[model samples]
Target: MTVLVFLDPAFADGRIVDAGKPALMATDQGATRGDGIFESMLAVDGKPRKIHRHLDRLASSAQSLELTIPEPEVWQRAIATALAAFADDGGGGAAGGGGGGAAGGAEAVVKLVVTRGVEGSSAPTAWVQVSLPPEAGRLQRENGIDVLLLDRGYDSTVAERAPWLLLGAKTLSYAVNMAALRHAHSNGADDVIFTSSDGRVLEGPTSSVLLAHAEGEGGTRVRRLITPALDSGILPGTSQSALFGAAKAAGWELGYGPLVPEDLFDADAVWLISSIRLLAPVNHIDGREIGTSDVRAALTAELNELIAAT
Candidate 1:
């Protein structure tokens, strides 16, 4: 089941709409031209986690597109309305939305989207969507995943050179990202990690790339975490940011990168982190296994605990 709440001024708490029915305008630029911004977040026990961070990123994305979105209060009200409606409407009953069922925690995907609205309109069309997360994501978290490296056809320096590319925004223009994932599936891989044309590891199509390194063991052990630089034309991942904070407090070192594919291969462990999927460990990159079974298991367990603590 899905719950949708439109951000309408006429309704102080926003307006709930039938998700099974048509709601968006056919002429909306967000649909026709992909002129929109969106953010996905996780909700547990009926409360959205890292909400302010998601909202902050949403604001950043809207500003990049020159879009005017409602204030944070409006979004918060709408999300609240959607969650309440979801519970009352029997949408996710006991197992999907708020801390029950098989995915371990009561979890849901809360997505905020704002389109450029109808062609002649000056106002944006904004809404909040809440629904169950896909099971494949949970499976990947437990079992890990195999990945293929794909070229994104851009150099590492493109972000500063081309602002119009909207490299740092979480926009609705996802055709290429989807296509890359499909290409990976067709090639018999579970996912993809994109590299820059100049050979820098960028990110995954729908997630951020993360790698971990552990030196020594037991009493002398030191753990380190690394991800690509923010200037590498990738959307800043909320999950990565939260996990880094949690990891740092747990005494793990943190680093940024203009990382190369070799960095991924040499790391003690690798993962693709995102909002909905959380963290997924990478078992293989281009058919060569990464890390050892024991190391991967230990690191995955440690990081997952950190993420949960966040």
Candidate 2:
């Protein structure tokens, strides 16, 4: 996996840099103590979809973290500049370029991460950096991904009190999140879906939940597309919103609320949605085999068409 980390001044070809760089803080540093915030967005082709929305969310998250962020326009310009430089390295120009990268046209994923700058012993520093995303390998696509239900449970009320349980914040302290993935992989699953101590579905470690139900006039016909409520404490996935709109446009009924594992087992179809992974239909959960349907394919086609049109 060839990945380039773009620093403030220019692009670099390797990992592990001199800790002397003002933007590069020490591992024992203040913000490195998991005392800050961050955000990641996909810059597909060259244009970032919902760029303003993502930036707005980032600002909200920073405010919740009691941290200040660069101005909206400034951040957007930084994102654009980093993506442009990264694409140039990929041998493509953003100009008649594909809104992003392509066959040697810079068709790569782009990510922007901003930490709480640096801190001496006393105050916040002003360092922030945006970089390109490495290509994620294709996995759990057609055949479906194996997911393990992790035993560790999160408090349902944390989102109300601390709210910054980092539930909504895309902070750098992703140790636990990454651990969940490791736990799932160790248990023979490609990912993990966190549940409450009592087994109510929360969300995938890095994706949103989508439940396919049977609808229509016919008695056992598959029906509407559903996801859990945002009030339920899941991250408000941008892709989820887009897909919901696409579903509505496709004449598919849209629903949202709580969904337990039993509900998943009972559903006609199930999928985990994300920006990069897009649609990953679940064929099996726990020990139950959920039947395959054309719903995901239809939904993906509809979404791709919607995105293309927009």
Candidate 3:
């Protein structure tokens, strides 16, 4: 199987050749040990959606870690060029031609990973890699996904203790994140949601949670879309942002605040959003059946419209 990867420096050859060895520094080999940042992005219609936002987040993460990155234009060009090649090779296709059968009809996932450049014996290596297209993100969106709540928390205290905790940064060190997802799969769930040891809902292992308002308060009826607050220590979700905007444009009220497990059940709708999954309507949580609520149809319609417009 040929693996499609974006070389940091552009290359013409599609196949991986010994001459195209990655310029990996010693620091990237195993010098520094801590959280490394990373970002997962998606390509729609053969183009990345909100590319600047993802890049902005990447730059911020690097800055927080005191690491430098290629200029925005350089990075953008590298990614764009690679995607164009892939799209030509059946990844997506020339833009505006429907790009059919290319990773779910011109929709693909592009992941960006950057590490701190080697700094002395104590510095970690800096590197970046972009995946061709993520099939998993596509699968989850097509078919509803099941999620299990892990009692383990991301250690909120670490965010302050190690300012470079990489939680906010899109670091490269993601062994724990991968392990959490595996843990969920091993337990019969398609994905995992992290929660505080004390039962405070955090986020999914790879997506953000959006809860629907079940009841209106103070004579103001809450509409369809809702999510946890940014201060709640959740990874800001790109798809959720788009969904919120769509809901608002369609006259739906979107709320953001802290929510509990009970809130998930009480919510008119519950979804896990991310670059890949887009929006996955959760059918069940734990062993209980959700989506039986009154707002199920409205919420489903709202999600369908959002996808159609996109």
Query: C-alpha displacement of 134 in model 3, angstroms?
Result: 3.9
Q: How badly does each model clash, as a count of residue pairs? A: 1, 14, 13
Writing each residue's lDDT as its tens digit, candidate 3 over 203-263 gives: 8877888877545664576566778766555667766776677778876777776666888
Query: Candidates' lDDT values, in order?
Result: 0.91, 0.59, 0.63
Worst 10 residues of 2 by lDDT: 96-105
Report how far off residue 162 is in candidate 2 (Å). 3.7
Give the poorly placed runs of model 2, Cα more than 4 Å off.
1-23, 27-31, 91-106, 121-137, 217-222, 293-310
Instruction: Report the number of the highest-lDDT candidate.
Output: 1
lDDT of 1 by residue, 1-310 (tens): 8999999999999999999999999999999999999999988767888999999999999999999999999999999999888767664455545444222457888999999999999999999999988878888887889999999999999999999999999999999999999999999899999999999999999999999999998889999999999899999999999999999999999999989999999999999999888889999999999998789988988888888888
Check candidate 1 and list the clashing pairs: 99-106
RMSD of each: 1.5, 5.3, 4.7
What would the per-residue lDDT of candidate 2 be over residues 1-310, giving only the tens digit for each residue? 1223433333322132322444345752335676665555555566666676667777777776787655676555555655555555562344433333211223344454555555544333322233333334234544567666665466555567667576766666778879989877777677777776656677787788887765565454545878876755567777778777766776678888666778787877777766555556676666566655475555444444554443
